[model samples]
Target chain A: MYWNEKHECIPREELEELQLQRLKETVERCYFNVPHYRKVMQELQLEPEDIQSLDDLKKLPFTTKQDLRDNYPYGMFAVPLSEVVRIHSSSGTTGKPTVVGYTRGDITTWSELMARSLVCGGAGRDDVIHNAYGYGLFTGGLGVHYGAERLGASVIPISGGNTKRQIMIMKDYGSTILTCTPSYALYIAEVINELGMKPEDLKLKVGIFGAEPWSENMRKEIEEKLGISAIDIYGLSEIIGPGVAVECQDKSGLHIWEDHFLPEIIDPETGETLPPGEEGELVITSLTKEALPVLRYRTRDIARLITEPCPCGRTAYKVTRIGGRTDDMLIIRGVNVFPSQIEHVLLETGYAEPHYQLIVDRKGTMDTLTVMVEVSENVFSDEVRKLEQLEYTIKNELETTLGISVGVKLVEPKTIARSEGKAKRVIDNRKA
Target chain B: MLKQLSVFLENKTGRLTAVTEILAEYNINIRALSLADTSDFGILRLIVNEPKKAYEILKKDGFTVRITDVIGVEMPDRPGGLNGVLQVMKSEGINIEYLYAFLGTNGRGAVVIFRVENMEKAMEILQEKGIQVLSPAEL
Candidate 1:
């Protein structure tokens, strides 16, 4: 099915006019339907008539993850519960889950966006798409599933786990477009090797990896191993799940659906807007969301905006690589350690797989960070002492490089946990 | 030839005793041991009766220890003896961070455990000076 393009390539003035009109309608709907939005809007003294133009969007109160938690389940829904067709929730590690409601129309819009993302990344109508994303309250699985189906591609609803089965179906179905996180894509390649199968024997062509921040080093690794073009897709559950933006063939940055969502880069510390090409936190406001319209939502993800029209012919604003979350930065003995920084060091080492975990603990009041990484078979040796020495050497190298001491724990191949959805790679146990 | 076993220890009182106890359990004798302490931690370097075996025993007892092949020069245990080695190293562009000599040998010779910043360059310097550099087997 063809998606609407009236919002896609419209002129700036026309798009802003449409956004202002939708902003007024969304404000009135929220004020009449959702009590939480009413309270926040009332606190800001913002009436539907006050938002006469797109510039007035700044007057709306910023919504946060905490706001979603305060208004759990259906508290943020702008429509009745009976009208909602599907629901998705966050990881819920912090507290009660931040639930998202999708009406039938919302689901259709979501599917259209995902289809656009897949097509933009070079998926064909006849190609079979393998959906390895999980299929529950998580949006990665079903989001891609419906998108592929809507695009008329044969859908393999293989939800996570069972690497052997995944490979079997991938080969049997002649899948051309693969959708999964980059780490899981690597794990699949490993299983293919263990089963004495060559990656070139598979008919896969493209990969959409997202839900967690991955390095370009990993993208090249995945592409070389699986013989497929890898693309980084960006989305969060608060913003109607994973199809919000996707990378085109140019592999520069993800092309966001600016017609439906307005993208802005803000200084994470000051909440002030920064120009394009400057690194800052991303704040999105969904202009056309019907059931759950979010205004000035703080994503907390660190990245920059690219307003330059991409060489791939898409006029949508692009977001560069997301650095990391602000609050998740770990301070180890006065040394700040972000997982991406550790990933950067590991990628620079070029010895281990992309799969890794950071273990942090306090040793006599001093923080010590230990990296658990898989020893690639290319560098594997049977001598345990030699391996131990290699670990020590790597630890010393990382210590010298990052200017902070780190211990390296080399594990047997495939020991670290793999996820079909967002990969969890960091574990910090320091109380401070 | 002499070998040195470097044991990592926290700057606590009984930590060294625990390491020594592990060595004693394995019946390993400490020929020459030097303790270098910083404000945070300490490195206990020992010239053991059996360097390899002592390192293994300590490692098995959960002590972080490493064995390195070090050159044990036969010096006269006098001030000029160390100066002679330093003059050769300095002329050969070798920088020694830390070094220690074993005592109680009746001033026969100084078995020095010296660490050069660059091992290959230091080995080249010693080779050029015709000094005896011991390997792990020689140690």
Candidate 2:
């Protein structure tokens, strides 16, 4: 049930010592090689030696996604191009794609971490992993591929799309493990239902889902529909991709690999680190990355860190599932709202489908939020008043939860565009 | 009591046409229909010859369709015809949620569909008042 037990379940003091050592080495590498780090360090009048303990980690400059974009192609890479054996870039749908490189040693470390992640999610060498995360450029597919290979498991690199064939192969090949985004997994379940097939027809036993923030309700839905234990795996392309942390079978929270990546929660507005168990922006520092050494990289993801020991017995501290991205946060008439909060409300209603889009428009000086949710069979009624009541109920629940009265629009089924990758849940027309 | 098919539709052009086209393709005749709409969405209530079949076809075509029991009563097909029925329901304090009317042939007179708060109470009152309530076969 455990992979790399020494590092995964290391004693608290021993793990801290290992983290400090690796942190020091990574800082020295960044200072000597990456000019961006050196310039920022000199501006703070700080040196690598100043990072004597993990507490000094706060002194290091925070790196943003813009910083990586400012560095462009390979500027943030600490090692030379020859040393970097592999390169990966984000989808860059927002702006410029942030590129990351990996040295051979970094690849090995990533593979080992992924191996640990797979085991943590209940996959073993005997499991056949059907990796549906896109392969090219995106780190999801290949990151999982290397890890499953490293775990000595059979991997079907059947990247995303062609879902019907993917399901066919899953059944034909007897794939025991599935790895993809949470939304994509639900789409697969829908397709299975459409094809008149049941989850029991497949041999899938475990699924590792990530790359987007999903609610616990989604986990239950996937578990029931797919007949598999859905495990949440957290990572970003900036860090080592897809294997930074993973939920053990305990399903409480994801265990961060403290030996390789140090995790912290910081107040997003103040940029000051928050105490454990407080919700804020998650900041991570890659302790052992060789090609690209990131120091206190601001993840922009909203989550809390739990220092309490998990029932799974992994000594590495756990991070609660990501709440939402700071960038995805919407300011409506001075009230902060996250789409996930709306999604949670909709899912909890049991009358609405998971497909919903948040549309924010500016009416003169006031910002208006209209939540368009697909009308499911359960909510539709022959009586207009009853249907209107369903809408009013959803609106009231949303207003109570979000503290801002919102317009609830009942859209027809399949009105929301379904994405095979990340689900696009928000459309902010107010942004100019 | 007759089964009426109700579909949730977005208030957009061609949505009504789309529903009708699907029903027409299945050779299902819409005897009487009423569209109730708001700025964002609409619910199309239909009294079709084959309510069960129409509901299945529309539902399989990805429409949010529902079937509900509604009363169909024969009217005089003249001025103030619906008023007389409403007056009868008013006397009994029976509230009508919604209603639509259509002409009937073969001397069956005009038929008015009634969706009321209490279907059985309205039916008993209408029957006792000597107003002819048409069944699905009569319609």
Query: How much does candidate 2 score in TM-score?
Result: 0.61
State the displacement of the C-alpha of residue A339, model 1, in Å, after optimal TM-score superposition. 12
The pairs that clash in candidate 1 are: none
Evaluated at residue A251, the lDDT of candidate 1 is 85
Query: What TM-score results for chain B in every one of the models?
Result: 0.82, 0.95
DockQ of each: 0.03, 0.58
Among all windows of ten consecutive residues in candidate 2 chain A, which has the lowest summed lDDT? A89-98
Candidate of highest DockQ: 2
Please write out the lDDT profile of model 2 over residues B1-139, one tens digit for every residue: 8889889999999999999899888899888999998888898999989988898888899998999999999988789988898899998999989988888979767888889999988889899999989889987
Q: State how far residue A290 of model 2 sits from its true place (Å).
A: 0.7
| Candidate 1 Cα errors over 4 Å, as ranges | A1-7, A329-432, B1-139
Instruction: Encode model 1's per-residue lDDT on B47-86: one tens digit a residue.
Output: 8778878867776665556666555665666779778888
Per-residue lDDT tens digits for candidate 1, residues A1-432, read: 224445555666776777677778877887788898888888877777888877777777778887888888778899988998888886442336679988898889888899888888888688888988878887889999888888878888887879898899888889888898766787788788889999888999999888766677777878888898999998888898888988888888888888778888888888888888999889998877777889889988888898887776667889997776767655444233556656666666665545678888755324578888766544443223445556677777667655567877765334466678545677766433
- Candidate 1 accuracy as TM-score: 0.61
